[model samples]
Target: MTGTEPASGAAHLRWRPAPLAGLRAVAPVLVLLVALLVALAVVDPGFFDPERLLAFLRRSAPLVILAAGQYLVIVSGGFDLSVGAVVTAGVVVAAELFNLAPGLPWLVVVAVLLLGGLLVGVVNGIVSTVFAVPSFIATLGMMLVLQGAVFFWTQGAPRGYLPEDYRMLGRSAVPGAEWLPWAVVVLAVVGVAAVLFMRSDTGRTLVATGDNDVAAGLAGVRVARLRILAFALSGVAAAVAAILVGGFTGVSAQAGSGYEFQAITAVVLGGVALGGGRGSVVAAMAGAFSLQALFTLLTLLGVSGALESAVQGVIVITAVAVGGISWSRRATRTHQPVRESV
Candidate 1:
């Protein structure tokens, strides 16, 4: 057939892409999430009910928010292992604030917590970039430092209660619409903002920097600033998560424990590359939901809580291995040279 002529009847019909063609990065996790949801429905039919589902979402909001923040850092080619500790520290600090100033407004306390988290993120970025310390080591050290400080200050027992207005965000619903929890509202807002940010020029540049800093730098991407911006946003996310946690579950020294790993695993499961550059923010949040579902299913099946960490470790390792192989093969094909016909 000539270039301009129809080769066959097939040429007359326009090819329609698969429903999930545009969602290649998130397809696996989406499928997994659907499967998990189905299983949960089967095991506990009430889970699909509006009230129960809203309650579940209320509980899942913190982790989903964390995953979104973690997505920023991971996509920027770094880790923020200190976020969990940031959450803990945020809550403890807020409680201490109230102890020192019993009449302080909740809004002011939230602002302080957010500022503290931002400061922590700045420190993490500076240590990782300015001092040339690896993010892993830097964040891990930060985690230890924060944990130690919290323990020292609180003596393993946090004092003061979160004001009623603050707790309402976590435990209450909209005034007229009891069906909608404030936590869900916050999650929706955060999710929308994350999606919008990912579509912006800065977000695209951040991904490019994560994918290849040297190339991005050559293109005048301001790599260091972007990385720091990413860490700063992550810190802010952890703070927001802390507020939600403190509101819902009350203050505790261990409120934010294990969250860092959970966030990492959720991002990995969402098909985000560990080495950097790739994955959707929405998918990362979905990963958090999937992880939460998996845990819920496990609990229904009477699994031991002790195995939760083990399960997370296995998920992280397996996801990284699989993603690595897939990325390697794609890279190989992309770099393959074309040969001229003799």
Candidate 2:
């Protein structure tokens, strides 16, 4: 009985999660987000006012959506550098389509944009997986290709305007709460979908593949398909974001410029591992909020807008460093042998 009791106690101890594991899982980005929000409130008390907050949410929605999509590709151990270009292409193509067929319905245009985005993603996935190209290079090439195509199509000056109805998704007010932006509704839908998807079996397998493709393949996960799917979802997200941006800001060649880095920065800030296999969609969204809040605070403080790029670069570098360090510490702890007293 005594021997059995000791064995049972040891088993229980081994089975229990570490005391700080829960906190650790959410700490990186969640804690930063809270801190940033508190600081924003302090800097500008009105920042938390309902109207201003809703405005902020509206402005941040597209990037938040982009971050969610980028999260999927990143967690699967791939980068989607072409998403920003995808956004630009979606907007430009929609505008061009509208110019050609002024009577075309907004919903049909949106569907076409989504399909185009998916096609772009499939190309990225195929180039990376089938052609043995690194995702970074493949996506980068895709970005350049998209940029050139848009330029050639527009002859260096984009033409056409988004229809009023098409802009509603980015600029309209909610039915019950006029103060709330329609972008908020879209953001909510995207957020919920992302959370649920991440909890699914396919999502788990995708993460496993990111962690170790060889092992995941051995376990029967369709690694290539998941990678392609990740890119496809990312493309769809960019299209959605483009629709909102086009509506809110109107058609412009540079409308979606630099969004790729922003999404990547937001994802990294959320504590998603660079090489993949770690992160939460919720945290990535929170990171997006934090980033937008930081920008707002900076603007309120009268900082030069030029510094935005520098700040983002620093955030990406710092987040990657911190994540790598944390991973190393965890790996070391996991491998360290337990010792008994003599």
Candidate 3:
């Protein structure tokens, strides 16, 4: 049929413009998931068991949630390379708190979550904004600082362990029970909160600022505040996720290692723009799940754990390339101004 199409009954048959870009963006992830499942099934049929799979997800929950948090900062025109360090710091802080004399109460744990996250967020936001440092450099420095501090505190190892109470957040405390992992629960809670936050005025402001800070500021969007909040929110979310991860994996010098890249890759795979100002929180979370699936598939395939880093590197490159191509296409469309001849 012609583009304008026919009368009532036949109009329904007229082809709608396909969601081609959306489909394309989603396609790789879907293919990857399918490939993973096939590989897993072929490797070991027992890998398909629901219980084992759920447990697997529990393990992935923290990284996925961290991805959701990083999406906010990146979409709002900033990077948070410090997230891996922030998470490591968070776990260390939690462990230290629990190690204190007289054994701290549960309230101290809650306070630690809130306070630790806010502190890190504040530092990231302030350093980036006030010093006018590029987020990449700022966060990179922050990561080093954190790593050094953690090392100094622990003397090259994590000094303490999460108490049984805090460990419950990680899913290991459940023991023989098959209930939802605490990591998943924490992810769900933070993930839902992030979705809601993105829907609020602050969220919109963050996106607007990311898209064009000059325009957003002229429109009364408090650009600096929004950016700071973005980093802070990310910091807090990382803290919460750290609890789960630390509990699940147990404390080590490597706790929360290399997670920043994982989270960023997940966000990009979910279709968030790299330079910011586009995408959804839900999609970001979906990206997290997709990453987890990829890792799981790799594990099932008997791929060496050593290869996981290589796989992550490949995913990051592919996602960034896709984002760049999309940006070029959009820029081409938008910047082609009208011209006239005399």
Best by TM-score: 2
lDDT per residue as tens, model 1, 1-342: 001122245553443234443376666677778988999999998899999998889989999999999999988888989999999998889889988999899899999999999999999888888887878888999999999999999999999888888778778899999899999999999988898787667887887888788898898988888888889999999999999999998899998998998998899788776657767788889889989888888887676888876775676566556654665754443222221000
Model 2, runs deviating above 4 Å? 1-23, 315-328, 331-342
Tens digits of per-residue lDDT for model 3, 23-82 = 554544555556666767787788768777777678778877788789988888888898
lDDT of 2 by residue, 1-342 (tens): 000112233344323224455346556777677777898898899988999999999999999999999999988888999999999998899999999999899999999998998999999988888787888889999999999999999998889989989999999997788998999999999988887787666876777888788898898888889999999999999999999999999989998998998898888787776667766777788878888877887788777889876775676577656655765766433222211000
Task: Give the C-alpha lDDT of model 1.
Answer: 0.83
Candidate 3 or 2, higher TM-score = 2
- What 10-residue stretch in candidate 1 is worst by lDDT? 333-342
Kindly report which residue stretches of model 1 are placed more than 4 angstroms away from their true locations once superposed: 1-22, 311-342
TM-scores for every predicted model: 0.87, 0.88, 0.82
Q: Give the TM-score of candidate 1.
A: 0.87
Error of 1 at 16 (Å): 20
Q: Who wins the lDDT comparison?
A: 1
